[model samples]
Target: MILSKRSLLATATAFALVLPAGWAIAKEQLDVVATTGMIGDAAREVGGDLVKVRALMGPGVDPHAYRQTRSDIVGMAKADLVLWHGLYLEAQMEDFLNELSESGNVVAVAESLPRNLLIGHEDYEGKFDPHVWMNPNLWSRVVLNVRDALIEVQPESEATFRANADAHLEELRELARYTTEVLSSVPAESRVLISAHDAFNYFGNAYGFEVMGIQGISTESEAGLQRIAEMVDTIVRRDIRAVFVESSVSDRNIRALIEGAAAEGHEVTIGGTLFSDAMGAAGTYEGTYLGMIDHNATVISRALGGDAPERGMSELLN
Candidate 1:
């Protein structure tokens, strides 16, 4: 039977609405753009062959003060979804990323965690620390966030995404176990960790180190002379032998720390570079999220007189 023209138009409209989302999912891979290496790693793992992932920040890149370039704006604009750390971690780029949510899916995975589980920022009123990845257990939540985001975009790949997330979560658990074992080996007295920035409060909470960064949590804040002097005095008094420099952060303040301690008759050396704001070189084991944390935990352990493999707990980090 021939349908009326109005009925045909209405039928076509309903079909168009119903089929476009599925057709798009089948025709194009999800394009996911992430702000930091950690979130980028998650998208890559969870999306697998179903998505194309680009990370805006890379090795030795500081997310705290990172500003999006023209290329970054283009990438985010073209992406199916955007992932970021949030919790003011990307302080400089927060406003832009926040505004993007009005038009598309923009997720702040670290900020998705329960408030009570997050540590309060000492000075950033009403904000919580954004370094939740320091603790593998805490990072597991982020992995699931990535999985859910990917599934939202392309539901057909749900099984693959879930499986990849589960495997990655297990790896995170293993990394945590290794971190605990190695860090626990450090003598309790030598467990105070000093660094250029206060990025490891979560690490200290998870692994029993007394953490101090020369600069505050956000690198945008300056390390005052008084703060440096106080840290130097603490190092001298405790004879803390190792201080870590972060790959993304400037080492000038770290040098000041060492010089200050030396003038006071204490010798403190940089233990090893840690991947705080970013991962290691791309295509290397340290470039991955697992490797970043592994490298940091191993470096901190071996630096402070603990026993751990030179390469890392897995002997695969580069």
Candidate 2:
């Protein structure tokens, strides 16, 4: 028999209320449900052997428009901890997650970041950009929050979580260093980044590039013909040679930009397919948060006439 989402949530809440006080302690590994691959990677890194993490959104999945399914609700309800990137990244899941938070161990990991460090959303007043994972230095703060969350749920594993988080943060620091070096190598005039969407604003801010996206911060927003014409004009006027596509967002707009440029007698090539709102396939290195950023930095640097190793930082990119 099938049940409605509301009914399932109600049932899940009632079941939780009946469980013993130390019910989670009975389980060997903490079951963690994360809204995105980035959060899931953090949970796995910090929780290590003590956690079994499930990322609701996988490779090529756009969180901006992703709504919670019945299975997602059930999994999040039963999870020992639910980590979501707040700041409206999960646009469709916010209401459901807020409802679940009242009865479950739900936390918006990205919301823990200081507002001063966040980029303001142009279309929405008082809303900040949700893609903090783009900057390693900023993401280090999110890693701390993940560590604190893990410690809050399982105090006994505080030492382990702290250790793992520190190790992971060190790797992020190295990534920041490598990205800085490579991205800085691009000529100042050639550092403009045009992509399928506004997901790279943080990356642009970090590396001093002028970023333009065909779509807004949210993929749900449509890109009109005038916007395409304006971008084509910008590309031709600036003599921009490359533009990028995202793994999750459709490359149709990018293709439009290319065609538009060609019509204007300017040639442009696809810089690379970047993992913007999503990571690579699950089993690949690019699937990890570290690998995702590494691949982006390497590809952008190389495509924009900067210096970056073909294999990316740590020589681990595939």
Candidate 3:
């Protein structure tokens, strides 16, 4: 019996399917690129095995100062869908993203957030804060927006994406609750959070802390001596316990704050390293979006005279 081309193709396909799952691979796959690791995490949750997600900024990378390398440009050009956190968080990449928007299905996930909830940029004045994801409650909204975006791109997988997004959103809600409960432990008097940069305004606003910063919203801005003196005096007079250093930003400013306080006969120490501007490494618990916030909540609560456990939210049983 002679086999025709169609009959041979059908037999080969049947054999391929019966072999193994990993052996049957497609030559082309969905291309997805997100600006930050946090956005990548959300996209991965929603996309699952159906899509590929790429983050422009990785662990310990400062988004504010990040410039698109030649490889990043190529990646963006090749992406089927690109998502970025708008609101000026990626100042350096703003122009690149704008240009990429004209060429492909590029989305600014944070743009869907309500204007009222966002804090305006200090120097830019009218611009809203780009760090909306700092608040877990606000972050949940972004996750939902991400689900919708992914559904729009791949309608066939809508059910899968929605379920994943729903599961992730539940985790985010739990994160918000945990954040509030943990922060509640900090005494009212010691509920001040002074960090190296002004990235945690939304966090403070959400959790009832008076947030102060040595530097402005943009890490590119300098912390003048006057600013340092003012914070030092505030710490000394107010008897503030500690300040925090971010993983992306240099600890130079925080070290200055500590030394200034020491010169004035007051002791100040860095409470702990905070995951700001980026998440921790992949595979580590601290690397996940939920873990990132959990770490921040635990650090801030303990540093500010609150009763917090070393292992983070009791959910982890630590």
Candidate 4:
């Protein structure tokens, strides 16, 4: 049954009170519920064996439009810590998450990023772009925030969390290096990235590529015929070769761009699908946060006449 917010908060309070009694004499693993797979991955990496993380949104799920299910509400209520990418990334869940924070250990990891570093959200006043994961270097800051959250929830395990976070941060540094190197291989004029939406703004900003999107930052923003026609004109005039589709977003508009370009006697191909707003399948390497960015960098670089390995930075992308 769909529980009202009041009932859900009451249920959470009940769970919080009784949960301690069920713990063994030994400490139990900290239970973490993150809003997206990216946040969950950070928790798992930082918390290591000390925490059990569950991501509410999985592969191909659009956080922009996702609403919590009854099961999700129950899980978050029981969780010891809840992490969500703030900055309106979880647009639909913002109010619920804010309300949930009143009683639980809830943290908006991405919101921890400094304002000066963030791109302002065009549609929403005072809100920053939520897609910080696009730039691994910037994401490193979020990883630190995750580490701090885990430590706050369970201070005794700070050593483990610190070590794990350090290792993960190193990996992220390497990912940033690799992406910068490969993405740099594209000629300046060919470095334009056109996608289903404006999810890659950070990536563009980080790597010096111009980005175009048929839809706005949120996929919920509609792409009109005029926008599509404008993009088509841009592509043809610029002699752009490839445009990308996102895993979580519909490709209808991208296809429209291609058709429009073709009608103008200019061919535009679909660059490999990018994992925007989500990662790959659960079991694959691409499902991991590192692999997700690696795949995007490799795909974008290769499609835009740059050099990147077929398998990606770690040779683990699938």
- For each candidate in the order shown, give its overall lDDT on alpha carbons: 0.84, 0.89, 0.84, 0.89
Worst 10 residues of 4 by lDDT: 18-27
Shift in Å, residue 274, candidate 2: 0.4
Candidate 4 lDDT, 1-318, residue by residue in tens = 345668877775665544434332224789888999999899989988888888989999999999987567767877789999999998888888888888789999988688899998887888888999999999999999999999998998889999999999999998999999999999999999999999999999999999998999988899989999999999999999999999999999999999999999999999899999999998898999998999999999999999888888977433
Candidate 2's C-alpha runs over 4 A off are: 1-8, 11-26, 316-318
TM-scores, one per candidate:
0.90, 0.92, 0.90, 0.93
Clashes in model 3: which pairs?
A: none
Report the alpha-carbon TM-score of model 2 versus the true structure: 0.92
Please give the range of 10 consecutive residues that has the lowest summed lDDT in model 1.
18-27
Over 80-105, each residue of candidate 1 has an lDDT whose tens digit, in order, gives 89998899999888877776776678
Give residue 67's lDDT in candidate 2 (0 to 100).
Answer: 86
As a TM-score, model 1 comes out at 0.90
- Residue-level lDDT tens digits of model 2 in 35-93: 99999999999999999888889999999999886567667778899999999999888
Residue 99 displacement in candidate 1 (angstroms): 1.4
